[model samples]
Target: MIQRFIELGEGYGDIFEICELARTNADRLEQAFIMYANHNDKQVASLAISLKPVGDSKFMPIYLCREGIPYNAEKPSQRLAIFEEALAQLNVVPNRFEIKHSSIFSENNLYYQYLIGILRLNHYIPPMH
Candidate 1:
């Protein structure tokens, strides 16, 4: 199986888009997760939803709002709240994890690859077949 992060222009109006994707594809929704990273000394987060492959396809699309929302557990950002509210409607709660900031990687693609590896290792996503 092949999994890829389909970036949705960070945390902006795209947050709504991500939520829409998950809601519209609720049946295919595999997982919802938040990754927190420290970028430029500020804690930020990326919200993503994993969708199952369609019709025996090998591609699993992970819709992501890469490192945009400010991370705050004590008082979650409104953006995060919006995402949670959307998921709540679908009875889905997001799993959270801390990750190396994208800035550490030379390219976004490399960072995504690293995240995919981590997901596989944690069993959040399937391993290579």
Candidate 2:
């Protein structure tokens, strides 16, 4: 199957959109994830929602708010809190992963490909058929 990341704007608003997408498509939702990475020595996260492939379509869409939130274990922010609350409503807790920051990639598409590889390796997304 083909998998791709669809990027949304960064912040709480985008997180809400991601959550809504998952909630609305819960039957087809494969996984909800928060990808964390260090950029410029600061922690940042991207919220992603993966959906199952449609009939005859190998492509799976992964919606994301790319590298926007500050990642802190001890400190929390309203943006992340909203995501957590939304996930609770959907009855699915997000799976977290530390990854290579997108900034390291020269192109945005490459960054997404890297993420897709990670997801496939983790079995979050299906492999090629």
Candidate 3:
């Protein structure tokens, strides 16, 4: 099976698109995620949704809004609120994970690969073939 992260840009206007993806593909929606990483000494989050492969297809798409939303336990984030609402509508709860920042890697793809490995080992996504 093939699994890939389909980035939608950092969570500015992309939050709505990510939510729409959940609503429209409700049947295939497998998981909702809030991945946290420290950037510029501030905590930021990446919102993502994992979907099952389409009928007979081997590709599973993980729609992601890369690290952008400011994250703070003391303060509520509007962007996170939007993601929560979408999750409520889909009856999906997000799995939160603290991770290494994307900047830690020389290439963006390597960052994604790191995330994929983490998810797989944690059983959040299927293991590689």
Query: What's the C-alpha lDDT at position 78 in model 3?
Result: 94
TM-score of 2: 0.93
Tens-digit per-residue lDDT, 16-105, candidate 1: 999999999999999999899998878999999999999979999999998888987899999999999999999998888999998889
Query: What's each prediction's TM-score?
Result: 0.95, 0.93, 0.96
What tens-digit string does per-residue lDDT give for candidate 2 at 72-121?
Answer: 98987678788888888888878998999987899998988888888889
| lDDT at position 19, candidate 1 | 91
Writing each residue's lDDT as its tens digit, candidate 3 over 1-129 gives 788999997655899899999999999999999989998889999999999999999899999998888999889599889999989987898998899989989999899899999999999999877
Predicted structure 1: clash tally: 0
Residue 128 in candidate 1, Cα distance off native in Å: 1.6
**Which residue pairs in model 1 clash with each other?**
none
Candidate 2 lDDT (Cα, whole model)?
A: 0.85
Please identify model 1 stretches exceeding 4 Å from their true place: none
